[model samples]
Target chain A: MESVSFPPLSRVAICGGTHGNEMTGVYMVREMQKQKMDKTGSLSVSIILSNPRAVEACRRYIETDLNRCFTSDLLSSPVTDSTPYELKRAQELNAQVGPKGSEEAVDLLIDIHNTTSNMGLCFIFYSIDWVTLHILKYIQSKMTSVDIRAIQLDLPISEAYSLESVGKHGFAIEVGPQPNGVLRADIYNMVKEAVDHIFSWLQEFNSGSTFEGGEVEVYTLVKSVDYPRDAVTGEITAAIHCQLQDNDFKLLQRGDPIFLSFSGETVKYDDEELYPFFVNECAYYEKKIAFHLGRKIKLTFPSINLTG
Target chain B: MESVSFPPLSRVAICGGTHGNEMTGVYMVREMQKQKMDKTGSLSVSIILSNPRAVEACRRYIETDLNRCFTSDLLSSPVTDSTPYELKRAQELNAQVGPKGSEEAVDLLIDIHNTTSNMGLCFIFYSIDWVTLHILKYIQSKMTSVDIRAIQLDLPISEAYSLESVGKHGFAIEVGPQPNGVLRADIYNMVKEAVDHIFSWLQEFNSGSTFEGGEVEVYTLVKSVDYPRDAVTGEITAAIHCQLQDNDFKLLQRGDPIFLSFSGETVKYDDEELYPFFVNECAYYEKKIAFHLGRKIKLTFPSINLTG
Candidate 1:
């Protein structure tokens, strides 16, 4: 593969509280704002609390999920009188820092999130953007305090839906085992450290340091599995099995216990062996996802460095 | 103490979904309703889903918390157009099984609950009632699978503010470490086993068996501690310390770390030593409680038998 070069990266945004009940991001943004962190080394940083209303109410969102309102079609749609609060906010955000896929977009964006699942620290992105991958590698190398991994959503950039997609290059940092609306000191510390590493990496990159490319393992989502439900009532009839509850990112084999029915029966996974993640997430219960299955693959990229 | 005797206990009520998002109770009540569990030997059991609307929405409550609406003052308050949904529901419930402090109340009531704290299986009640204490002793003896303990709120029966206080002799079963809006099979199983044991104990007592109650250990409420908050914004400034996160029911001494501030400062406990429970509960964050401190005590009671 040929070596790649990019223009100097300077402008960046750090977003939190996109899903307002996720306290890690909410607090992270608040702390950054309190410190008035606008410029760090060679990069100009913008700290944002994405959904103030939801944060005040301690809910995921007031109308629709703001995280899902960032696709090109939604972003470009005309605003109306009855438009949801999140959609209106998304438009304002796009106008301020996004106008996504345009020349004036921020060089990079980092949206921090928390989950109820025990998925240590994960970087989730759309497409195979080299800058985002290099940042993930740098953070993974520097942060030895927690397990670090990357998840590729396999969507076209125009179709990507999330706050991070508003930037020229971006990804979401999802750290967890923390419940929604509650903060854990250990989890909060991990997020802080990861964000610090990202800034350090960006500083070096802007100063013209090359990032060596290597075989990086990434998980691409295969499918989502929903909890077993009663046909008549549409109510869940089973829960994630004890063996799989906190075992996010573990390789799941066929015939492994995945769910335990209310009637005391174990429902086994019957598909090919794959890794499972977001296991038993509290917020996903409304989205109908009990857990997601992913296929892991090794990706090799060329060395890259800042150009002018 | 004299061996207390009462009319053969026959009518009972098992209440669940009072707080709505507590899945253990919601599912227990749903399963019972599905099985049409009305009679268990000589005892007539009424299994009720206490807050149906909240259960449907998967929220703690639709308006004000239903669990706190069962006090005498609130129950007797006349309903108006602006009455909160939960308050009205409380009155309906009091009419069905309570008319509290009246002769028509059920003989025994068990209100099932779940918390995000790692306090294991606990029995919480108001006042010192021999029957409730004996029931706790029976449950502690039978359910060896999980840690079993009891907490006394030290409030007069009429001043008690929960659904269980509506019964002639009542208490609540609180199980946890489960997040709100999420269910665990292990937690569900423990709740099932406890409920089964309660019914078995009731059957044996009604069959003229005398319960041998000697010494039972209980935790009595001392006070509650709130999270460190910002003076102006009222937002929490620190999180429960890593050492104390899930260490509910552990003894804490003065100078022990209880909170870790956002800027990496440790806030030490400066009060008397006590056993802490409800540590880092998700729901109580709004209630301004980081955890509740209690003093452990030993209560000695005489064995009692049912009277004709």
Candidate 2:
């Protein structure tokens, strides 16, 4: 596949609460809005609360997942399926932020989220695009505490439906171990720090800062594993094993307990070792996802030609 | 207020998951059914999964909460409101477990639940009935690790809508710091031990085991406190303060920090000393309950109630 690059930074959108209970983004946007962070930055920073009603209700969404409603097929339809609350919100957001590559669209978008899983502080990119990789490397260099385990989207980058998908340089900053609807001061400060750093980098680049982009280690998605369920009933009969409950981003070897039934039976991972993230996320309960399996790999980024 | 008593050695029902994601009871009931624990003891033990579909779905409930659907007015209506999934389930459950005071009705009910809050092990009684208090004392006496705090329902016993309200001696066991849909083996074991002890006590009592009930310390519900929110928008702006998070069943002094906002604003308890439980419960988000406040007090039970 050919590599893609980001253009010079102009407008940036910091969107939150695409899934309302993920309060990290919601509060980050709220704080930025309260403090008028947009006025201070040389770059035009638009702080967007993607689903205000869901944020107010402290739910994931009113009708359907806002994150999953932004795919190309869903967006391009003329007689749009605008009945669900999120689909309408998606249309409104796309019109406001992008249709990226369109005139007056944001150059970059940073969507924020929190999870109940022990995912640590990580950036999720849709592809191994050169611009996205360079930005990831820069952020990783600045924030040493950020885990090196970046997740590339399982679906093709073009089919990405997340809020960030509408922007030229869009990605999500997912932080957690924080429960849904409950914000933590530590998580708040960490997210704020990362957001501030991203904008600072953008400001420097806008003022003509360029660098020789290098290599960074990232994890790519393999597949997701669901909790143990009854063959006939299809109801989950076991939970993520005690040893692996919050062990997101950890390597799981063959024969390791992945689930534990109430009857004291243990189910082990029967395959080769793989890194698991988003372990036992509360929001993913609807999807019956216990965890996502991924593999770590080093990807080299060619020095980007920065536009002045 | 008049005190009520329970007849000795009648049918007993142990109900689980009237609100589904509370998995302690679900697992307990599943284990009992699998092992035929119901048949081992002389007592007529009935194991019921209150909302099987929700339990199967691993959700709180498909529609409305089944626990809140058992009011007398709801049960007595000639033309039933069976639109919501839970309402219909409640009617079916009432038909199966009780018409409460009828001959075939369960003599006692134990509804089990698990919470995300740090509410260790607790028993909630709908009324200040003698048999309930005696059972509470017996269990507290037997299990030294158990906290003595108890919550008396604010609603009149006649109007109680929980699954337990359908039994002559009905109460709830709520254990926590456990997340929804994720069963902790420790919590599962703890609930099973309690249920086993309760059954053993019942069997012993029916076989001429007699004892005088005594005074025990109990905590009664004062009221619930909601997290601070944006007045106009009604969106929660603060989280349970770090000091107060996981501080369930702990005494809150007159000036204790309760919540912390994104702007580093700390909101303190501006009232007399009180005990707080169910702090930062995930399920109470819909009700906007940050925590429930209560007061500890001593209550005595009459000894003449041994029906054998």
Candidate 3:
């Protein structure tokens, strides 16, 4: 209700549980606070336990991936027709945090996450700028286990992405490979370490100007993914990201062949299957191949552009 | 016709005529290119010449300042009623360069600009984050004359702005009081210094993570001096650094009185003599002062409520 309540002298934000399946970071922040890792000066930690509904229901976001829906365009939709409640929570929390988009003033964000691949005990991705350089050095001194990459996030490079789309210079530390108990503890320890790292460095590091964040290297815009649906039984697959990218007929083309039924019994294409219709030879570009030829780069899918 | 094109290995962007009067940066880029300032492989400078029509017609963009028109809501209708050409040009350039909102590859953009500061010598705005840290340090170590800041941008920090709207991360280097060859030379020197700094560093730095560029120290935003039509005429006589706190009004509230125009006959907020108003109150905010309030904290405009 208060428009501008006095900001705590120092604030720390640990946001997680966007996807019910990824609640490790959520509980970790809570447990970290529960364990009393915050002892430094006036440092207050705020945790946004997003998606209470999904967390209660034990689902990843019922309708959508919470991470992909934070853009300005998608966030502008007033109606919550098919929008998952988690995103609405993000929007509301965003409103509470500060102004949307450019006016947001997030000092430091430690978005805790867990990746599918069990690589890099934890990876700290950031733009390789000078502020980040000192941050990297300072953080590396604190965290010897985390893998940090200072990538140039521009052309001929991967697009850049912020941790939670909060639009500040933040990084997501992936805990482990799954939504298991052990992974949660790994995430908890990392967060505790991160908080300490921030506290120590921030207390002494005052030489630089304010921290301005970086551009995205590669865009992780996994807009939409198709799930397998049973026709007669009407049962949806319990898992995602597994069968989504396999030889599933969901990504059929205008003229490409489509095999129906898990046993490969039915055969169809543009005229037969009821999903992923390609209008032209350049229609289907969802996850199509984008490569280079002699002198030009070409993008091709079932029906989206045969030539560059 | 291409959505995004980077055929040139290096790019140099020049945005001029933002004020319709300051066209020095525009001509300097063109001249520098004629002299072959654009280098490939190590550095690619993309030139974004702004307000081509304003440059030719010789008038500041009226109705709406092109620089202030980069808001998300206004992207569709960048300019209103008048300044059709300016709007159209903006659209074309954005189309070519593509929106910064896209998670696609981007190139180095050095916007050339000229200012009418009856104050100090020329300065170059160094973007913050990873890349900018190097740029700033190198600029300081290499180019000693230019002043720099690492202000959080008013526009979306992630969304790169056109010259007209290169937010707080970017700087508006004021050359010698305009209308003099010295102003033109200052613009050239600044651009050349930036280009040179980037080139020298690229040899050693090669590339860095986009998000991890550098940190900034002193940051500031451009607070426009809004006025009524008939209230004030030429010659901005207000002393600089007078400090106007935009606390009372909403972020973009129009007709907010900012300055008092004095012309002997009548001192007015605008030439039209409309109702006097100023965003002096920022009523919604509990804390309204601009200076540091004791604790080691930074002011992220529009206070974020830690607790709901």
Every candidate's lDDT = 0.91, 0.79, 0.40
In model 3, the fraction of reference contacts reproduced equals 0.00
Most accurate candidate by lDDT: 1
* Weakest lDDT window of 10 consecutive positions for candidate 2 chain B: B1-10
RMSD of 1: 1.2
Tens digit per residue, CA lDDT, model 2, A169-250: 7888888877776666667878877877787777776666666757888889898888777799676787778888878877
Top-TM-score candidate index:
1
List model 3 lDDT by residue over B1-308, tens digit each. Answer: 11111122233344445545454565554445555655555655555456666654443554345655544444556455565555566565555554534433233444444432322233333233333444555565676655443333344543433442332223344443232111223344455556556556544444432212232343334433422232353212211111222122112223433333221122223232211112211110112211111111132222111111
Error of 3 at B240 (Å): 6.9
lDDT for model 3, on a 0 to 1 scale?
0.40
Ten-residue stretch with the least lDDT total in model 1 chain A = A136-145
Please give the distance, in angstroms, between residue A276's alpha carbon in candidate 2 and its true position after superposition: 1.7
Q: What is the DockQ of each candidate?
A: 0.79, 0.36, 0.01
* Number of colliding residue pairs in each model: 0, 0, 70
Candidate 3 ranges beyond 4 A from true positions: A1-308, B1-14, B17-19, B62-64, B77-83, B118-128, B149-151, B157-176, B179-183, B207-216, B222-308
